[model samples]
Target: MASVKSKAGANNESSPYRESARAGAGSPSLVAGAASLSLNSSRAYALEDFDTIATVGTGTFGRVFLVRDKKSRGFFALKAMKIPDVIRLKQEQHVHNEKEVLTEVNHPFLIKLFWTHHDERFLYMLMDYVPGGELFSYLRSRGRFSNGTGLFYTSEIVCAIEYLHARNIVYRDLKPENILLDHDGHIRLTDFGFAKKLSDRTWTLCGTPEYLAPEVIQSKGHGRAVDWWALGVLIFEMLAGYPPFFDDNPFGIYQKILAGKLEFPRHLDFYVKDLIKKFLVIDRARRLGNMKNGADDVKRHRWFKTVDWDAVPMRRLKPPIVPKVSHEGDTSNFDVYPEDEWKKEPPVPPKDLEIFKNF
Candidate 1:
């Protein structure tokens, strides 16, 4: 097995786990170093078969890197996770769950996990590399999206989430940070660490507070319906540059969420306003616009009636703006990883055979 060592010496200022704020309770970096197991697959694996171009992002468990495959010469996002950290935090199940959910899902708007591998120290996931940056940063830079652009992205996310719900998967986390932009600027849903397959229902108080549905905060049993509530909040944020419910105090935000009040800009179009009203309804049973209606309801909304669904998915629509990469090899420009932290490798785990027994 290949040995690993932290590039950052003892006094390095760059903490790879700085993105912990975005991950909340499910940070990937925290779990990266916990598992110390190796797989017994007959197939041989080689790390040097790929070139690490740049660090795209980092989380509690590990960091994601842009790498070029030596064989296929294709670009891919390599997500590394520390095994011991994951087992220590009791998140081994969550990691398995994420892999299972991602394997079962196949949609253009959903990020695709191509392959997975693990060494004694780290588990690596190879995924489609979305060239565009995160949708959240895009929106922040643009102030707010135009109605046409917002509806286009929202409609795609609705389709993706509806597909997950239909498969009995509940995506508890829905936030701008989790939404990645494809090469064409279309929204692609990523990160299923907090997601679970719902056989019945759950009362876990997990998810971004700002995007949480009222039921989620109250610790009430919430199924896929919570996703609907979040969709409404997401759309409002996209249009207004902020979530419908917001307060500096966490308790105040919870109160606003339970109240389910929506305030729209006066100049917003009627169609957009109406869609928000239907989605923001306090009643989850009725919030998604007619219980019988599925994602089609949102797709058929008047605001999106003019959107070319086929074209949007095909990357036909011109993106509002393109990201500025410093150079052809500078994929790191779009990512937030600190360069000073990339000099050393992280520690590798000791080999253990039992780890593969459950997987």
Candidate 2:
């Protein structure tokens, strides 16, 4: 059976993607750097410029569609978010931050945001349409990955994380659901809604419950240390077929994170176990990537000893799971949605259009 893609931000008990407290503005200290990385394209695009192929995924504000450009006939993923829903959900700043961070960064593993535009009713982002679907679907189908396969996927993610940390950008969300595989099976990190460029700490209580770090759970003004913790959880899930911390509710999950106890399966290699232990430390300062040597220490770890740093970003290494994508716009890996899901809601004019002037 083909694996089905999960809903984007449905209100599930464990769905931390739909929850956030106060929305804050980015710090002024990083304004110049953010501006330098701004993406402004001269081409003018409209909603009618593309023909919708399918509703690939849904989010808190709107839906992601697989589309084909009328002029070039090229396939692209058009992310259209309802303006009124975004305003109602208090996600204005997060939308802006996603565009800001995506515009400025360029890495092999990160998704590319081609351009952005907004109308009175919706905000649209044009991006590369990765043919392969979510890594979550693939992981579910396989149950668990082998040590070699898990190492391959996690190594690619480590490179992406290192690049983000170098720029002082914190990718707070790093789960299988947020990662998409390209046709060649290389991972493309998506969903920058929770990502931020921070010079210090941010107090926002957000992110998936199973992946949240101890500092975030305690509301201790978290920074990039949270991502390292998530990475450790990701590594464990990839090998063990489940997260290190699981519970019947979010509160229960937090308790396990605070307790910081890990029970590794006996089959895990000694070096791999040590790597996970260093990453899951409750103290951020003691975390592997947060230490003095920085991400260098993580790359030098025993588990990643065989990784060729030079070849990782270059796509030289062979991928373990090359998706069987037939053409530019293949939706077989994604689940099918109702054809009129986006048409059900009538468009309502946004009252505060000034806030989205830059969009």
Model number with the top lDDT: 2
The Cα RMSD in angstroms, rounded to one decimal, for candidate 1 relative to the true structure is 6.9
lDDT of 1 at 154: 79
Which window of 10 residues has the lowest lDDT sum in candidate 1?
A: 1-10
Sum up the clashes in candidate 2.
Answer: 0
Regions of model 2 farther than 4 Å from truth: 1-42, 341-350
Who wins the TM-score comparison? 2
Q: Model 1: per-residue lDDT, tens digit, 108-182?
A: 778776666655455666567776667777777888888877876776787678778889899866777677766
For 1-359, candidate 2 gives per-residue lDDT tens digits of 01111222212321111111111111101111101111434565555667878767654556667778889899877666666677777778778878889888899899877777665556666677887887888888999888998999989999999999999999988888778889999988887777899979988877788899998888789999899999999999988899999999888988998999999998888888999999999999999999998899999999999999889999887899999899989888776756563443344444576777777
TM-scores of the models, in the given order?
0.80, 0.88
